[model samples]
Target: MTRFGFRYRARRRVLAAGVLAAAVLAAAGCGGASGSASSSDGTVVLRVPDPGNSGVLARGKKDGSLAKALSAVNTKVAWTGSTGPFAPAAQQINAGQLDFSQGSITSAIAALGQKPGFKLFAQIAPDKAGEGILVRKDSPISTVRDLIGRKVAVNKGGTAEYLLLKALEKEGVKPDQVKRVYLNPAETAPVFNSGQVDAWAVWAAYSVPEISKGKARFLVNGDQVGSQNYSIWAVRTRFAEEHPKVVQAFYEYLRERGLQQIKDPAAFINVFTEAGPQAFNGAARELTISNLRQGAAAAPIGAAQLADFDGVARFFADLKVTPAKVDVKPHVLSLAGSGA
Candidate 1:
């Protein structure tokens, strides 16, 4: 389909989906509620992922602005003490144990393939340099073709794996020519640095520190590989339907803070550094700020986001990573004024 045709189709399907969501919400009310708890006075306790380790969320929570803002909408924040590897977070959202979290498009696609428990309500454009294939500075393998016959570490069904597939395809290399070691982000660094894996396909959280420390360099990034792995926020379908106002408020909070983060990247980066053990100090910290400066802020979902979602869904289906291509329009919703 032409670009305009695809976008128009997306808008129509999304509108239909929005109506369906409202109906689901009404049905949920009759089913005795499926999301976070509400008190006798009717204040919603929004159960969300812990923000202590994340840059934007952590900063917002620490300064009390996030809480104060939510109170105005008759919602209370409940920190669920969880961070991400978003697949598990997706599962939590499905089970109603969590309400919201941010993850890559690949994770959302994979989760939706299993169950339609959430809707992608917001998106951040791909951070091209933030995710890629990482190799030790002295590794003999320097190009995508060099990856043939080599072992690479990647999080199965995640951005790293997606990027690897794209990178290999771009270089005209077949997937089976390389041995892919499926490992979570935490396990990748140890195996890659110890020479157990020839290279690690990873995102910024893991790749940046190594790159800044001079231990590794990018063999290829999302930009070179033609990646569509945008960063996305998922809210439980029930939660969003039951509390649309709260969801919109949260999105607004993120959008505003994200804009501020872009303007003064260091302020947010400093909060990120102080929040956890994985300190991106000195050059690493500076590199992160630079990435943030170039990064796209979060915004309500739109046609561009829908197009990206469909692209990822089709890519995964073709690779057999997913059983079938997902019709992303039904599984996503655009809030008022969010259309592209």
Candidate 2:
């Protein structure tokens, strides 16, 4: 053959080899590095969010415990962390892009208002100190009543907004009394620090750093204002129905690990904070450890938890935070206990 002809034949052979390899992988049911798929070997790949790099699932992924536990039930995890607001996470779950994740009950209720995309499998008790409104330490706003007429940043339709609403109600302040600046967490952080917003209704992720640095203080914590919020784990609705065992196994593992972490926050600090990109340092790290010690832990979904979820849904609906009313009972799966 001529040199050009020989080169053409070599290229064809290489292309054929690549095609064969791809077919082999497809036949094995490999769903790439991050997604939900089942292999011929009876292993199920489940896609889940990383939970801001400080949640149970993130820590579970850092160590081998999560995988090892799931292996017994023939399930694998794919940590496909989400970016941006809760709406995106809800959209992903609705579109079947994610298999499992954890978020506040407020977000879950908002998600259910649109469609039956996911189901609550387990719950974490109220982290009273994990969320609240924050103001500069030297700010004049010393009481919830003082928030009237001041600008406060909150992620609309989220825990922060919920907290702010409840706080205002507690203080007899009308919804329109305070200026609600609808800003996301990232936006609220810089604005709050720069004194553009009088106060920011936020979660521990943003508040802890500022508090630890002595630049901010909590105007009102969830506990102080009787927050009924709960942290919940959700599985894709169809996925949960299709793979109940997998969901059960993962929930049990999370519950076990979460309990352990609650008992000894230091033991899992490395995995929760040091292993992820959003790791905390210095005063923030110390403050995180302290908070975790007193924070909530994973628990099996039950009647009481469902009742609280219903209350949250009702509250959001009544306040027009959610589009319409949602009944959370139908959207939850009581795997380990009675949740009716």
Candidate 3:
């Protein structure tokens, strides 16, 4: 062939090879993309009750802390806040409508015993001596001893119930010795204010409102019960298995941000107010900072924390809340050593 003809033929062959290679890479890319999309099909949804009470989670979402952290792992988070108490949130998790929920250790333990569909995933916040037993401002009941034979309202299957039981035990009182009235904080608050119930076992956030209204006085705090407890985050076992990475990322996000908040009280208080309504702004912010400091000083999740859980489980078992004692090791997920 002539020189020009030979050059043209060489160019045609090179162009053809390039097109073939492009086709192969395109096919491989398509297959890999399809596999990845299929592998990550669903978004993880975390249900938290009352944005007011969920400081780290709520502030993380509002300030993009959760979103930024989860984005690094290519996971999506859908945070839904509950309007009522934790029972409704627990029900949602039981019904499989939620992947996980934030609740008190007592509530999660009770749910695990009653509903076998869920499992405790992690301990979120250690009890900070915050919750209390409250009585009407001018009532004759000055001490827990005065509550004997009195109608004391407590939300059964809730943190309040556990606190009340422990408090009574510490005071050498039997559970059945007092008239226990089961009422949620929302329902019991009004009645307690109207002198309907002699006392109310409630968290500090709820108790603050009643106290501010001159309707209630703090009788005892959680620290007086002789047990150090914590709040927990739990998920359905199936859901956790399916999304282990997502679960790890969620836990890490919370821990990092939670610890950061624990370090800076003023910053946390500011972010907290921005997270939700200012319903309990002043008191809530101050109390949360105080509680965070306490949790920070406590032992980080390790064998000691596990032992603490064992004590908690025994407490519940003794109260007949669970059929028998449970080994908390199998249920607790420790992100600290997981290297996630």
Best by lDDT: 1
Question: What C-alpha lDDT, on a 0 to 100 scale, does residue 59 get in candidate 2?
Answer: 60
In angstroms, the error of model 1 at 112 is 0.4
Report the lDDT tens digits of candidate 2 across residue range 209-282: 68988999999998888888787777877787778889888877777777777676655554444533366667
lDDT: which is higher, 2 or 3? 2
lDDT of 2 at 181: 94
Show where candidate 3 strays beyond 4 Å: 1-54, 81-84, 269-278, 282-288, 297-301, 336-340
Of 2 and 3, the candidate ahead on TM-score is 2
Best-to-worst ranking by lDDT: 1, 2, 3
Local error of candidate 3 at residue 186 (angstroms): 1.9
Which consecutive 10 residues in model 2 have the weakest lDDT in total? 1-10
Assess candidate 2 and give its lDDT.
0.70
Q: How many clashing pairs in candidate 3?
A: 0
Tens digit of per-residue lDDT, candidate 3, span 220-259:
8777876445666666566666667777777766667666
For model 1, the stretches where C-alpha displacement exceeds 4 angstroms are 1-33, 272-276
Q: Which of 1 and 3 is the better model by lDDT? A: 1
Give residue 122's lDDT in candidate 3 (0 to 100): 59
Candidate 3: what lDDT? 0.58
